[model samples]
Target: MENISLVIMEKEKDTGFLSRELGSYEVKYDTEYVSSIYASREDENLYVNMYLTVPGEFEDWKYNAILDNYDTGLYKDKALLAEEDEDSYNPGWVIKFLFLENDNEMEEKINELLGIHVSELERVLSQLKNIEDEYRD
Candidate 1:
């Protein structure tokens, strides 16, 4: 079993458009990542965000490769074209909801957002944790 933490927040009923309106939501924060899952029935959309931690030592090629694999279409064109600067790279990504028709759909979307699988994410996170633990030794 992989080590992970999942907290399901409150169920927010009809509260208007999530993008334009502020609805009941929860934010999960940590040193490596900060995620927010918004469940707005009115808009029938669940917004997802997983801000990744980019190591300062990561080079331009490696960073661009990650973005290239993750972003779709013109969604990341600007970042792709941007010059390589240690101060300019944004490490976060946006994962729009696939289907928000029901609770099960939302769960599935959460598990498989960002064009990355849940198992892959867990494995990567576990490896990162192990590396950090070793650094402290």
Candidate 2:
């Protein structure tokens, strides 16, 4: 079992009885796919996996995770909705790991999952520093 919000967060996007997906980032009106957030770990390596819905279908983008199809990659922009919903993109985040001994492992997995090369997870790194700073004070 999980928290109410946690369970809903794990869903493609919580749906109302009318089948309307609603949340803080609900894809209402002219919107594309919903987003899924998850935390992962491997031995001492930890990471986050964000699954954004496919345009027009609200479907998982995993099928598009092919290097050859990089041009049509789902994670190319790393969760870009559609041209109309650009302003709604607020750089959402999830606390993925407490400790990751092999730093490069997460990057490698992200690269493989997104069908691209990623040197680092800059946003998370910056946020991690912020968290530590807060603790220091």
Candidate 3:
């Protein structure tokens, strides 16, 4: 049996369903192709992967930011900098929950990753129910 199933949620396409509960960050040079949130179930554990990206020119920005928050400030004046070569774009993360025990654990994990309150997590979880099981992977 497959122990994990995940559904990709895009901020642009799923805004109507995800906007109020799921939050997104602003990144310079970002392409819409990056996933917003990935909600998954691993056996009995719940996981939410928050994905992020920067523009190709600022490809290393994500990694730098992860290592030091101060690096993210570069985006404030990024437009003034000379454009860097576009080799490839890489995704970033806020947190990754491997497994969760119950609704309470899910709520806590979601809150930590999304920076939302418990109530918002509750709402997101409820909305997830309407998605069909065909999304499983």
Candidate 4:
């Protein structure tokens, strides 16, 4: 497995009068492929949104397959499949993980989420590679 490194590209702290949001950060994964993360905190909860832009066009069946395979068991509750937008410029899937602000194992939970993200990303890339190999054959 490749070492996963995250770099914060942008950050913002909310100072609104009645807002519960603490801050938000845009993170980029230092990997061969393009991947990014957006994290925000609202009150006692933190939401981490991970996105991997597909190399080419997006396929509905591939999206469904990824959701079926990864979005289950322990990840079922914490990780959710974000809705797709037809009008959006970028075509990719997003998996959102929720964490409690005061949780004692917050770091561990975040690490777990990162692991899942990397695993799922590898799965997607493998499938694409297989398709390319088949075409070459």
Candidate 5:
């Protein structure tokens, strides 16, 4: 039973956006993964992973990946990414939420919101718990 799902997300860099408007770019973050990683916790009660992307940041270096910039405060010149796993490539600013539990409750909720069947969500949850366990322990 896998419950892991991958979604490309973006952050406004907090230039001048509201706190509640951070996670609003839903449609654009749902395509072509620049990079991704997952890890679990010690007791399998916690999970953590990172999402790296070069969304909208179009430069000669870092691979040119065109991301939408409709209402986002980000830009094509500046890059917004992260490096948490130290194993996979750098992740974007937006962090996908991963909770430990095999009930598929989160899956159902995401399906309700995104209207997509992501059995891979379970896969991410399990991977996160495993990776987190290594560092947490």
Candidate 6:
């Protein structure tokens, strides 16, 4: 599994229509799965959005399986998966999670969220590898 970390690039308060504190983060990962990370905190809710891109050609079933895993997993209630866009040039998946702000454990909560994402990625990679090994047999 690749080590995933969020490096905050910049953060500022937006005073526009929907006032919120916005943050841009650089996702440090060994694989090319995550492309970008953005976060916003409004009221007591902190929303984290991650853009993920899987390399090579992925079958629709495999893609749906991953989604199903997330849907039934621990993050099912907190995470929301954006609809896939097939017409985009660089097709990717956007996953958004809403976390209630706990002043004392904010950092720990963020780390836990990242750990969950890493776990999912590891699971998918393991499945893909097993399939590839079977084809070689």
Best by lDDT: 6
Which lDDT tens digits does candidate 3 get at residues 62-117?
33332333122332331112122233244232334454435455544444333322
Candidate 4 stretches with Cα past 4 Å from truth are 1-46, 52-74, 80-91, 132-137
Per-residue lDDT tens digits of candidate 5, residues 52-107? Answer: 44334323222211121111232122212222323433323333345424435533
Model 4 CA lDDT for position 109: 52
lDDT of each: 0.38, 0.30, 0.36, 0.48, 0.32, 0.51
Pick the TM-score winner. 6
Expressed as tens digits, the lDDT of each residue in 1-137 for candidate 2 is: 22122111222223312232222222212222224444444455433434433332211222222111223233444432212222223322222322223435443433343332121222323344335534344
Candidate 2: TM-score? 0.23
Worst 10-residue lDDT window for candidate 2 reads: 1-10
Clashing residue pairs in all predictions, respectively, total 0, 0, 3, 0, 30, 0
**lDDT, ranked from best to worst:** 6, 4, 1, 3, 5, 2
> Comparing 2 and 5 by TM-score, which wins?
5
Q: Between which residue pairs do clashes occur in model 4?
A: none
TM-scores, one per candidate: 0.36, 0.23, 0.28, 0.42, 0.29, 0.45
User: Looking at candidate 2, what is the lDDT of residue 49?
Assistant: 38
Which candidate, 5 or 6, would have the higher lDDT against the true structure? 6
lDDT, candidate 1, 80-127, per-residue tens? 221122333544454333334455554443443322433333444445
For lDDT, candidate 4 versus 6, the one ahead is 6
Q: Candidate 6: lDDT of 122?
A: 71
Better of 1 and 4 by lDDT: 4
Tens-digit lDDT track for model 6 on 14-104?
A: 7323344343222334435556655666576566656655555655555554554442255555466453434323445566666434533
Model 6, 113: alpha-carbon shift in Å?
2.4
Candidate 1: where is the Cα deviation over 4 Å?
A: 3-5, 8-35, 39-57, 71-90, 98-101, 114-137
Candidate 5's displacement at residue 54, Å, is: 3.7
Could you list the CA RMSD of all candidates, in the order they appear? 10.3, 17.6, 19.2, 7.0, 17.5, 6.5
The residue pairs that clash in candidate 1, if any, are: none
Model 4 residue 27 CA deviation in Å: 11
